[model samples]
Target: MFKLFKHLAFCAAFLVAVSASAHSFKIGELEVIHPHARPTTPGIQNGVAWFGVKNAGASDDRVIGVESPIADHAEIHDMTMDNDVMRMFKVDGVPVPAGETVTLGQGNKLHVMLMGLKQPLKEGDAFDMTVHFEKAGSVPVQVWVEQPSAASGAMQHQEDQHDHSAH
Candidate 1:
């Protein structure tokens, strides 16, 4: 009775929240899904954003650039460990093969560096970013600020496991 009604209400609210947080944008044959970044401290000047690009077409594409108003500049970067120290370097692009999905986060080793952030990225906040593709052109997306999920615990360590084209 009352308990059942309360449970149903909770479920409804949960569904709404999930749908609101799940975002995607499409440009040509590429679909940019759930672009997100971890919340950062007030004094942190740099942050990273991650997303997956799904290429449904019969050709390959590369993410050549990124632009965000919240940062002075953004570039594709790769994070890896060299010896016992971590190293990050700028990359020319991240390739998205034909009929494949390329993820830039969740331990896949590539992320976009939002350099010189204008403000701290707080949880539950979102900002606009444009992803430039060599073939598909630029697609505008909203990057959500959120905490890392338990499944993405590897992100907390800053360790990554993929290789990319270095510039």
Candidate 2:
């Protein structure tokens, strides 16, 4: 009976650790949810990171920057269509409205561009990253690398198609 109880205790602790590692994190009133990147092909120098930023505070906040050792530079990028051409431009900050969630990745509208990648992001890998906010200061986060076909930005594609049909 004693040995069986010990085994169950160990199992419970292991499960807790695994679940905690996969959970979201918060800094003050800012919540960072499921921060992840997609696996990159060999020799690709650029990658993208996506996550949901929820602001529970009564005031607004801005995400000013992101830093990661795996990349030489990281910046916020915005994509738009101009005269039948799609273009991407760097933005200084992303605004998070009060009591709302700002999704950083949705059909290329907004994303964290990781330029000059030191190495290819592999599936099931994770790296340390820091998100700088105007009001919340800096918060450390883990950016997980997921499968290429994951449901990260794919949902946005379907939404885009639906939107186009309305026009």
Q: After superposition, how far is residue 80 of candidate 1 from its true place, in Å?
A: 2.1
Q: How well is each residue in 10-108 modelled by candidate 1, as lDDT tens digits? A: 999988987887789999899998999889899977878889999999999999999999999999877767775667788899999999999886547
lDDT of 2 at 76: 80
lDDT of 2: 0.79
Instruction: Estimate the TM-score of every prediction.
Output: 0.82, 0.75
**113-146, model 2: which lDDT tens digit per residue?**
7888999999989998899999999999999997
The clash tally of candidate 2 reads 0
Model 1 lowest lDDT segment of ten: 158-167
The candidate scoring highest on lDDT is 1
Give the distance in Å from residue 88's predicted Cα in candidate 2 to where it truly belongs: 0.8
